[model samples]
Target: MFFIMIIILSITYTDSYANSAHSAIVMDVKTGRILYSKNISAKKPMASTTKIMTALLALEYGDLEAFVKVDKNAVGVEGSSIYLKYDEEVKLKDLVYGLMLRSGNDSAAAIAYHISGSIEEFSNLMNKRAKEIGANNTNFKNPHGLHHKDHYTTAYDLALITRQALLNEDFNKIVRTKRWISEREGYNTFYNKNKTLNQFKGGDGVKTGYTRAAGRCLVTSATRNGMQIISVVLNDPNWFNDCYFLMEEAFREYSPEKVITRNNDIKSFRINNGKVERSYMIAKEDIVIPVKEEEKDKIYIVFECNETYEAPVRKGQKLGKAKIYIGDRLIGTTELFAKENIEKRKLIDIIKNFFSK
Candidate 1:
């Protein structure tokens, strides 16, 4: 028997997600799967939410715990500020906290200069990271998204960027932080402007932004039962409320289905050579995707592997691959591995006589 196994999973449909924002989206943080969307690809000004990228760049290229003096130009740029003075020394980590928690434009500038030597250069890096994250529609003209005609991102792109940022533990901690006290000379305490952390259950992070031209924008993330989701809204009068609705609806409608468990048996195969007569196959990683609960029966995992193995089966050895399907659509795949080490069977009966039974 050629060991082909199909594991049934579930996924279905739900009503459309509604929101008042001009462009909005909800994405599963783990899989980058969109749970909800409305005009998600429309490019719009990102405002202070731009700081999310600013913070991400710093975490990637700058030393967090190192103390560095603020650049001369970072002081008193525009919009929100941690009021960093020229040549003021602060830890790179604190600047990130200020950038995220306080939505500090000055902190954004300081970080930009500290990391890339100039705002122009830093924006270049931001664009580079956006591309790497698959946010092709996003562009950064300045570290602090004040107002540059070209500085914009689609709701989907922003959500993608936020998803990338959320992967960093440091970034995650900063955005979720409600208040931060820096060692700066004045206005030492910074309170996060993103109210989503306090306004909704399971709300953890992201950022908030507003400018007359951009209306109001918000990016929010929440975690429930080990599943995290990111939501982005651009140019909305009721940003927070819209985000909350998006979050609630997604959580209510979708489920993180663990279609495959890591290091667990997916199928057992008969062996021809050594050790045990049978060997089991498993995936090296878990495939968890968000899907509608009622449609669970529609999702299935198709395991592709050989019916039997010839020789020794090494634990963790790649045996085959599992294709995850939502209905007929192939959603994802993971490589399957041997569950345990099975040494080859030794020549028995006659050998025992030679050894003396």
Candidate 2:
């Protein structure tokens, strides 16, 4: 592999509230870049933030319009609750809304049981989903995140989980909501506990968690100027303020820059044993990188291809790849494809060209 080195200019900022959180991280939602980190990998209880994964699985696998019969186990499971009653019929989507907006432990259990038949099985699914989303340090013991010895996730892992959850439109819609009224008769209106949704500019969907052992844990997301960021803080006394500061820092520091566009012509490669002398290649898709505005100039593109190819090359055939970098870090990559066909030269044509030469 050829190494491409990019030198990005670093920005200077004061760390005034760094000590507020025991573990924390701020990540770019689009690029999955870590903008700020403090003991981000430390294993800690995520409290109700584990509901993010629960909500994610429900949205992905359950039909929103379908009504789930509230199970007996879902009621009175502990922590905050939407006070779902046993055998009450509720829409899956409404339960999700209640789960996220209200931080309802009862809602979480109902979703867990409806989707996977039991809390233990749903916890297993949450763990599987965590690993699938690259949150390796996470383990889920229950969907409500009520506190179990094995129910723990790092700040970085929670950020990773939130990033994945934010990609779902339904998940985004639910978490950003400030208030939701259930259609059920006599049901109390659910209000979001995540204050950042209203308090912070550009703030969107995410979850908040707290327990005596977990302290205050929060995962918040916000979007500004087309760039979205996710911030996670575990066991912070000033969770809201800390997340706000981190988000502002990321938005102020970084901007998304388009590096390449699909089908845009790149450098031509020499073609051997073909009617054409060169093959033009284009990027397979757009590649965007999030970087500091001042450091945008340091973004580099390196194209790697074989010296020559024996063609008949077909249009859109993969030829090589374009690698993008920022300060020695590989940020993105896209395959380079032949823009047009290049048929191999016929034997008779080769003979005639030889004679002419």
The lDDT, on a scale of 0 to 1, for candidate 2 is 0.83
RMSD of 2: 4.6
* Per-residue accuracy of model 2 over 17-86 as CA lDDT, tens digit each: 3658999888776567778788877999888898999999998899999999999999888878888999
lDDT string for model 1 (1-357, tens) is 111112222323345555678988888876677777778778899899898889998998988888879898998887788889888899998899988988888889889988888989999999999998888999999998999999999988898789888878889988889988887667788888777788899999799899998889999999997778998889988888888988898899888888777767788888776567887898766667778877689998787889888877888888887777777866666777888888876789337645895
lDDT of 1: 0.83
Judge candidate 2 at residue 134 and give its lDDT: 84
Instruction: Supply candidate 1's per-residue lDDT for 238.
Output: 81
Flag regions of model 1 displaced more than 4 Å: 1-16, 183-185, 267-286, 303-321, 335-357
For all candidates in order, the CA lDDT equals: 0.83, 0.83
On a 0 to 100 scale, what is the lDDT of residue 41 in model 1?
A: 74
